[model samples]
Target: MTKEKESILDVKLFKRLFQYIKPYKGVFFGLLILVVLLAIFSSATPYITKYAIDESIETKISTDFLFYVVLMFVVLILQTVFQLLFIYYAAWLGQNLVMDVRVKLFNHLLRFKMKYYDNSSVGVLITRAVTDMERIADIFGQGLFMIVRDLLAMVVVFGVMIYINWRLSLIVFLMLPLLLYATRIFQKYMKRAFEEVRNEVSNLNSFVQERITGMKILQLFTRETIEYKKFKTINERHKKGWLKTVWYNSIFFPLADLVSSISIGLVAWYGGLNVVLDGAVSQGDLIAFIMFIPMLFRPLRQIADKFNTLQMGMVAANRVFKVIDTTSQIDDTGTYVAEGFKGDIKFDKVYFSYVDDEEVLKGISFEVNAGDTVAIVGATGAGKSTIINLLNRFYEIKDGVISVDGIDIKDVTLSSLRTQIAVVLQDVFLFADTILNNITLNHPEITEAQVQQAAKDIGIHDFIMSLPNGYHYNVKERGVMLSSGQRQLISFLRAYVTNPSILVLDEATSSVDSYSEQLIQNATDKITKGRTSIVIAHRLATIKKADKIIVMDSGDIVEQGTHEELLKKKDGYYKNLYEVQFLQEEVI
Candidate 1:
């Protein structure tokens, strides 16, 4: 069996947890009051029988006895009515409590930096926040009130037994030590098993998500047999975890039954012998004694199961709190945006790395004037993307200053800095929604006519209209409904709709066909007429028309000049890239 870790919470969790409930204190007080009332009513059931047997059965017919019987009936009816009402409100309050927590967790995750998402997985983050939060919520919903009910009932049940006959009560209570010992052992085992079960579930979810997304890849490589074999390994691990749980659970039930059986047998032997030999206990008291034994021990049995539930919930709570506990190291404190951007982009002696002791960008420096088309041409993994990412502030600079419009990008608010910049990345992502919605997300209030005009100028409107729903077509996940060239065209339109002052196009037209390229080139030429445009592409055909060409290698700028000026340096990186794609080297 798997070993259970220590409880998820310490003293600190209780203090932090209470703060979230401060606004709903009144509802909690009402719940506590109802729990007390329910417990009191349930605890009185044994008492009513004791009185009926001891007094009413002896006298046979007295006005006092009749009046007591009627009173008992009235109490039962009142208990049932109020108990139903208690359930309704308890459930309502529990739902609202979980709703509040879910909303807070989601909003908090959004506030964290992109780096947080980069380092975390989809399954782990989702399971912790959603499924784990629900487990913690069960404590307040069903478990809390049940604990109070059983506790109150135990005390009153014991009092009734002692009053009916103290000697018999003493005999039945003797098994308390053995019961507690057995429970502690079983609880330890079950908690560990459940934690393993949770881990296995997480693995299953992660594998399932990956398999679905990469179904095409598996088929492409003809690796279905290998994939199936790998999946079996995960499945076996999950089954082993479950078997440990099942085995422990199977042992506990029989052990609980043995304890309960012994308790009952001991009560019967003592109660029966006393009546026959010494007249110490009456027949009526014996019946009530026997019935109350199960009532007493049943709650204890449930406490064993409930405590298991409580601890399992706590394990989940730790995972949920771990997410809430994460605080982004990077935050934007500046609240103002530059009134008018001069498009003066400057990077001064920037040094950065994603991993320690291994630099990605090493002391890179460059500057671009307002309304200039700066094209960066370099080999793969030459840190071209790193420069674009730094400008977007997706990753923090270890040392150096990246300024926009003479203000440090770090000093400006993230929202404002990103708002002024527009990026058309090589990997074009589109939500499964209408074409119009995808283009206008950055400017949702943009007129439909404006959207069509933008698409028509980019030469994709006619192709889009050829589809059944035209602009209203569902894009499918990641725009799978459209071809690569078609998706690239729409991605360009999205950036155009934003109307940003600084536009970053990373391999923007690499996927588009030649026919669509001239059209997109015409539209892009019009949009970048007065805007600062930064283009990063290996294709010399695309960057040849740029006002300035920057050639990069090993995260450092090797050469910078006008296209004609760079071409004059015959052996330079730009000149080499031009020779590779020489067929389309002409800039229209």
Candidate 2:
């Protein structure tokens, strides 16, 4: 939830964004040269007009006038060519820069610890990756380069105006201070407004995304009207944020135009007076002053608009850099690679907390020898799942060490450590892909034959073949095309095909029909044999065959033994839990 706080014109942020431009320096410099040419040619046209009027038309030289007109037409044609190149190259550079940034950002997100995602909104991240990136592209394509071209053109216009007649040029210069002041005020207010708009945009995206994803839940609870009202409130705020920008634009642009018009009128009135009375300012000079005033002042007005674009890009850049600069990723500095895990794991005095000063696992110590099936049975919130998450290195421990095969997990590479373990959760998630792809996860080393044999081994091969296309059948998003039991079966096949040394099933059989449970039970028996497995289940009946049972209560291990040994104890936690489940089963 933390955001980057920096100045509106933070030079450091600009330099960081500029690093992306380094890869395509050739295109960028070429674009710059094109912009320079555009500026020179654009400023030349008005001056050429001045010369044609004074030397050809005013002097009544028909042949000279024809030549100058043709020369002006050629200048316009060449300017058009440069403009085309500038626009094309600028857009190409912007698109390439954003593509690299989007890929890099996605890679960074992949390495982040689960803790970061637990606090961040998926909708906000989507906005950063999609919407905010578009704004960044504008910085290069339409913001900075265009502003530079306009400023350079304005400079050339001013230089020509002074060279023509200093007195008339002074008239135009007098209005600049006021225009600059207005522009400065406009930019200051606009920056604040832009930041508000971005924040609201993120909020709106988050609200809409969440509502759409959870539409079923909303309808189930009959809270559609309530959710609609909430969305309306967020949408209204987004509208107001945008309206502030509009309000500022409404006030600033007219003032700028009024100043532009006044400058032109002053130049005309003074230059006409001089031409009529003393002929100090010629008719040609007066006409060019009229042309030059807009050239000089127009960029000043356009600069304000372009600067707003630049400001929005910078705002987006700041948000993006915050994600890139985040240090919440798990440290992968360990050089050791766990080649063949023996599946022996030890958690020594481990303590962990998702939030500060609120420990979920308090000095919980346990061990699983190689090739042992250990069942961790506990009430909800007793940290049964937390242990599985820690074993996979999904969250870092605050205290103590977790070791696999006598090597501390933190000292082994994450990929090497995780590859050796496979987990089947109560909630199974499969990508929108074919059944074969879901099982193999597109792993290059896992072949179709291996997946098929694994499916047959797990006893789901017939169930899959009964589907529309067997292994090739596409399961839509989150495997919604399949039933809950079918999804769970797919997960089992996925875990089995991995051939992992350690298997963890966290409430994997808790949410299925009796028939599916039987299939899962059969699959479980095939997969867990001679492999180190940890089963966390609410149904005590399924875990009775485990080699060892560890009973937990309120983050502490309360009992540890095999099923028979624990049941033998009078008023034991395991005995009481077994009796409760036994009664529930009998009643059913």
Candidate 3:
């Protein structure tokens, strides 16, 4: 994957991320106030100690020292309370913001055109939605507010030190420029390193996800060792990406520590000399100045760490926004709605291509009247399935029109268009859910009674009852608990339960047992009884009962007629294909 250069601090992206916090502004602003109070109380403790040493301890006044000690305790108690409040509120705000972001990202993904999934990696999208979102939460939970609190403490500490003795303060301030310069250099390198790390993480996710999903294929082909080597190579790259960040931290953090130690040493040496030579700085003031050195430098060091969190959030936000900003969604501006379509589908001189300059359908035209069962047959890559894709508007046709019930499909709302049409593909997908939930898909309107009746009508009700749990049986991931043929039966029932006006079966019965094929054929007959049905099939013998058969080859329809009508033409393309493809099936 090519890396894109991203700014360490993207103001616009941060502004967008902050918009999610706007709804919870009460909590956000409350956290801000608590952070400031925490800083003030923490800074006050050092001054209290200084006062105790100089006024109480030096004079040996017991009452005065006791009063100072009590005041210091009050300050510490308030700081602890504020710190707890800050932690709680920050966590609440971050979790709420991430929840909102994740929902929006998921909803946005639902709107993307099917073409986007065709080209994008499911694993990378999962990373953006899941892992990247967590990093963004860290920006709010641990990053921004902590930076604010630390910086405020540092400023307050510096002000107190200057007030105690300006000479010592100036000596300490001299080390600031060198530390700031080192921080800037560290930020630059860490930003690039983090970007690479995120990219490698995404690459690794994509690789592992594909490998796991295709493990059966790899092992069947005896490619386990080969794939293992490839995985190690990718894993090594991911490790190297992370080590770059570690290498930067190792060098920069110790250098920061060295500078901080030098600053403390300078303060101690200068303040002690002033106390002895001129009696200008008291022992308590010298002690406080030494304590203030850590307060100043520690914040600077922590700001570097918090800034890393901030930068990572910005990177994650940029990736998330890229997906949300994509315009590759089906246009749903058409306002047309009908109570129900009559299911008269017309493809008039339609042209389509999945890729540019490569036409899959060349001026294909056909019509299926309401209640007709038309089957499309062709060899692979003949654009047979592409027809089904266009009818559902999963893709946009390049030219011409596809209409249903005398209304151009493009002029109707997507929801209205799709709700009336149901498709069952060759490869069925089932969620890791109960058989009933997989069929109903959580649609309240599709009740248990409706699903059972539909399954019974399709002759699969007994088959489902034969299972261990009947309709409640759990079909493990991708319906792995059931055979392919059983999965197809469930799909037919699912499609039937929708009571769609139009039904599409795209090679739905291929590669199933003979008994299962018989069941599927029975289910098909029931579902397509009164609906306008289009079937795309490779096994032409099964579609002999279709009212019309459309033969497609290389982006063109070579023949169209009833099965017997076409078989009468000895020299015809459909007849020739039937002899070569289905003559053996007829003999059997």
lDDT of each: 0.77, 0.89, 0.88
Would you give me the overall lDDT of model 2? 0.89
lDDT of 3 by residue, 152-261 (tens): 98888888888888988899999999999999989888888888889999999999999899999999999999999998999999999999988988988898899889
Kindly state the number of residue pairs that clash in model 2: 0
Misplaced by over 4 Å in model 2 are 1-8, 586-588
Q: How well is each residue in 1-588 modelled by candidate 2, as lDDT tens digits?
A: 223343447788888988999999999899889888988887788888888888888888877888888999999999988999898888889899988998999999999999999999999999999999999998988889999999999888888888999999888899999998998889888988999999999999999998898999999999999998999999999999999999999999999999999999998899989989999998889998888888888888898898899889989988998999999989888889988788888999999999999999999888999999999998888899999899989999999999999999998999988899999998899999999999999999999999989989989899999999999999999999998999989999999999999999975655678888888888888899889999996555556788999999988899999989998999999889888874577466
> Residue-wise lDDT of candidate 1 within 1-588, one digit each (tens)?
222245433446546655667678888778777777876777566667667776777557564677667777887887897688667666666567767777878988877767788787777777877777777776566555566667777777778778778888888888867777877787777777778877887787778777878899999999899989988999999999989867876877677778778878888898889879997877677778778888888787877766666666666766677787888646777666755577999999999887788888889889989999898878777888888888988888999999987888888888888888988888889998888888887465798888888777656688779887988888988899887767777878888877688989876565668876666666667667788989886455557678888888877888999878877896987777776664355543
In candidate 1, stretches whose alpha carbon ends up further than 4 angstroms from where it belongs are 1-9, 62-73, 85-88, 442-466, 508-519, 582-588
Top TM-score model: 3
Clashing pairs in 2: none
- Error (Å) of candidate 3 at residue 54 is 0.6
Error of 1 at 89 (Å): 4.0
TM-score, candidate number 1 = 0.91
TM-score, per-candidate, Cα-based: 0.91, 0.96, 0.98
